[model samples]
Target: MILAAGLGTRLLPLTKKIPKPLLPIIDKTLLQIAIETACKANPNIIVINASYLSGKITEFLGAHDFGVEIKVSVEPDILGTAGGIKAVEKWLSKDDFGVINSDIIATVDWDALKKIHKNSNATATLMLRDNPDPAIYGPLCLNEKGRVIRIVNTKNRDLSGAEPLLMFTGVSMLSPAIFERIPAGRAVEISSEIYSPMVKAGEPLYGYVTQAEWTDAGTMENYHKAVMARFATCKTSIGMTAKSLKYVTIRPPVHIDTGVYIRAGSTIGPNVAIHEGSVIGASVILKNCVVTPRSNVRSGAFLDGEVI
Candidate 1:
């Protein structure tokens, strides 16, 4: 299940206009990336849980033709992480499935995770990564055998024999058994509600450690940083039969949506994307930003943050 139900309160004014998952990082929305990543796993069906601006999500997914069956679970009221799982209990009952946070962008090895889960006979297998600073995301302690012993605050330096801390990577393989552990009709966090209890009960919870890049774009700063990072690696290309003004300076790695009017002396890109119908003013400068459709950037303006 792709968890996209959270109200991204941290992303404030931007999220107030558009859902966090729908916000562009580079050129594509976070939801699109998550869906594409999950598609690589060859799952029979992909279930997405959406709450904030559910119509936009539904419409966006509907427009795309993903190979697998796509299903959406709309929550009338917001449900915490664990509650969202419970909300999709019926769909998950069909098989042991994968759960991922929609906002996290990572290159996960889904096949390897599935293999490890089956081999370990674990109720749940969590993807873990070594983190230098555990204070921000607490720490996951593991025994010598690599079994998760507990999650503890990094401030408690008094705790002895604690191995190097690892942070949860927001991706996991879970059996249907997890649903049995959570009570119905209550909002709960997956970490605090389910994982913590399972650890205390000595239930088997395996961890898959990898040094992959992961970014949680839940805040404006992180969002901006992530977009720039992604743009840096994107291949530069100019679409076939596209027109460009002689005086316009477009650096590499930019995507100009069709019908965009980039006027003379305007500089776009190095890391930028302008959606359709956006009129780039003369002498305007846009760097490391995204201008959504139908927006107007007046002349002599500098746009860095996402413009909608």
Candidate 2:
């Protein structure tokens, strides 16, 4: 299940116009990237839960096919991570299911998590990453055996063997048993409300440590970072012919989509994504920012750390 119901309060104006999941990251929306990533796991079907602007979610899903059966679970009132999954219990309870947050970009090893959960008899297996300050992000402490013994300040089991705390990547593989812990028709967070109590009860919860690239695109700054991360392997990606871009100094890692017109003498890049139909005036300097579709950047304007 892909959790796309959050209000995206942190994203502000960007999200005010479009749902967080629908926010574009270069060529694809965040939701599309997440769904494609989930498809790598070879699941029989994909389920997405939407609330805020649920119509757009449904419309977007209908426009594409990710080679898997995709279904949208619309929530009249926002049901959080736990409740979202619980509401779709009937479809997911057939077997263990995977859940991913639409606001995050991650490369989780789903097969590894499935194996870990199956072999360890764990009720749920979470994808965790090594962070210097897990406490700041709410830690998920794991033992030497890779069992999650604590979440944030709550610990249900003894933690004498706890390893360095890790960060939750918001990607998990859960068994049907988790449904019993989540109440229906309500907002229930997975960490404090569900997992923490399960930990205290000795229910096996495991962690799959991964060294994959991940970024939470819930905030504008982080969203910019996520877009920049996608260009790490390639220098610059131009959606159209080079003849259309003349006298423009494009630094590496810059992405200029089709239909975007950049005037002469403009410098763009070192982490920039100018979407389709945007116009960049002459002598404009854009760095570390995103230019939304159909926008007009006035001449002589300089943009940094912004989304316009």
| Candidate 2 C-alpha error for residue 114, in Å | 0.8
Local accuracy by lDDT, each model? 0.82, 0.86
What is candidate 2's TM-score against the reference? 0.89
Q: Enumerate residue pairs that collide in model 2.
A: 156-200
Q: Which ten contiguous residues of candidate 1 have the minimum total lDDT?
A: 236-245
**Model 1 lDDT per residue over 145-200, tens place:** 66788877445643455568788988999999889987888687888778877889
Q: Which 10 consecutive residues of model 2 have the lowest summed lDDT? A: 154-163
User: 129-195 in candidate 2: lDDT tens per residue?
Assistant: 9866644567778887988887766433333444576888889999999999898878898888889
Best by lDDT: 2
Q: Give lDDT for model 2.
A: 0.86
